[model samples]
Target: MNEITSHQCNLNIWAHLPDKVWNRVANIYELMPGWIGYIDGIPHWFGQEEDDVYIQASVEPSGLSFYAQMNQSDWDSWIGAFKLEATKVLGFEVGEPEDGFE
Candidate 1:
C-alpha cells in the first residue's frame, strides 16, 4: 500500500520503544488468524502475517506498532484519545511515515 513505509535500517525499532503505546502491539494482539507478524529492521512497531495485508495504521512512523483490527466497538471506546495520550507521552505525533526520517 502507499501508506506503509519500508524499514530499510537494520534494527528492531519496536524493542527500543517505551511501554507507552504499542508494546502490546509489538509483542501481542492478533489482527487476524495468521495475519499478524513481527517486522524487523524498520520503523513502526508491528509485525504482519505477510507483506500483502493492507492493514491500516498498523505501523507507526516512529517504528512502533499498533493494531488496525481491534474489535470495532472496543476500538471506538478509546482509540482516539488513547492515541492522543500515547503521542503526548512520546512527545511526538503519529502519522503515515512519509514526511521525514525516523
Candidate 2:
C-alpha cells in the first residue's frame, strides 16, 4: 500500500486492472485524508487530491471481483452519489461513505 502517491491517483476501477495498479494507488490512498467505500461491494478508498480518483481494489484479494473506478476528472460528488444508486442496484443498505483515510 505504500506505492500510491499524489501522481498515481488515476487508477483503473475495473476487475481486470493489474494488481500493481492498486498496490501503487493504495499507498497514496492510505496516506491521504479521504473516505472508505464499497464500489459494487468491493472495498475502496479515495485517492489524493480533491476529487482526484477512487481506487477500488488491491493485490491481497488476488483474483478479480467487480470494481467501478471513475474518471479522475469526474466530480467527487458524483462518486458520492453512487452510494445511494449502488444500494438500489445492490439491494442492500449501502451505508454512507465512511471517512477512514485518516
Candidate 3:
C-alpha cells in the first residue's frame, strides 16, 4: 500500500455575491480544466485519482473559498490563472484573505 498527500489553497471570494456575478463565475469554472460541476452545491474537480489532488469550492464564513489539493507547481499555476481570470472578469481583486484581500 502507498500513502498520498495533498496540498491546499483558498481564494477569499465573497459567497454572497449576486447571482449575476456568480453566473459569471460559473462561466469561468466551465472553461477550467477538470471541472466536474457543482456537487451538493459545491464545485468539484476530477483529481489524479479518486482520492488524489483535486479542487472544491467550499462556502465558509469568510467567503467562497477554493480548496485545492495538487502539486505545488500545478496548484500555483492553476490558482494564479484562476485569480487572474476572476479578477479580470469580476472587476475586483480575488486572492487569499491572508494576502490582504479583505
Candidate 4:
C-alpha cells in the first residue's frame, strides 16, 4: 500500500467575506482551468472524488484554504495564477499570510 500526501495553503482573505466578494471569487474560479463545480459551497477542481488528483478550496477561520493532490511545481503555478487573478479582480493583493500579504 502507498500513502498519499496532500499539500495545503491559505490565502489572506477573511473567511466571513461578504456575499458580493464571494460572488466575485466564484467568478474567478469559474474562469480558471479545471473548475469542476462547487459542492456544499466549496469549490472543487479536476474531479470531486476522494481518490482523484484534484484541488479543493474551503473557508477557514484564518482565510481561504486550498488542498490539493498535485505536484509541487504544478501547485505552485496554479496557486500563483490564482493569486494574480485575485489581486487583479479583487482590487487588493491576495497571498498567504506567511508571504507578507498583511
Tell me, by lDDT, which candidate is best: 4
Residue runs of model 3 more than 4 Å from their true location after superposition: 1-5
Ranking by lDDT: 4, 3, 2, 1
Task: Provide the lowest-lDDT 10-residue window in model 3.
Answer: 1-10
Q: Report how far residue 24 has shifted in candidate 2, in Å.
A: 26
TM-score: which candidate is best? 4
Query: What's model 1's lDDT at 55?
Result: 32
Residue lDDT tens for model 1, 45-80: 223435432233333345544444333443343344
lDDT of 4 by residue, 1-102 (tens): 233457899898786778889889989999887898988878998766575478999888879899988767777778889999999998899999988885
The models' CA-based lDDT, in order, is: 0.39, 0.39, 0.75, 0.84
Please write out the lDDT profile of model 2 over residues 5-96, one tens digit for every residue.
22222212333546664454344344433457545545565642244455554333222222334553343444445444443443343332
Candidate 1's TM-score: 0.30
Each model's TM-score? 0.30, 0.25, 0.81, 0.87
Off by over 4 Å in 4: 1-5
Error of 3 at 33 (Å): 1.6
Q: How many residue pairs clash (N, CA or C atoms closer than 3 angstroms) in each of the candidate models, in the order given?
A: 8, 3, 0, 0
Q: Is candidate 1 or candidate 2 better by TM-score?
A: 1
Least accurate 10 contiguous residues by lDDT in model 4: 1-10
Cα deviation at 49, candidate 3, in Å, is: 8.5
Ranking by TM-score: 4, 3, 1, 2
lDDT of 3 by residue, 1-102 (tens): 123346555666777778988888888887787888877677877652366778887667777677767766776777788889989999999888878887
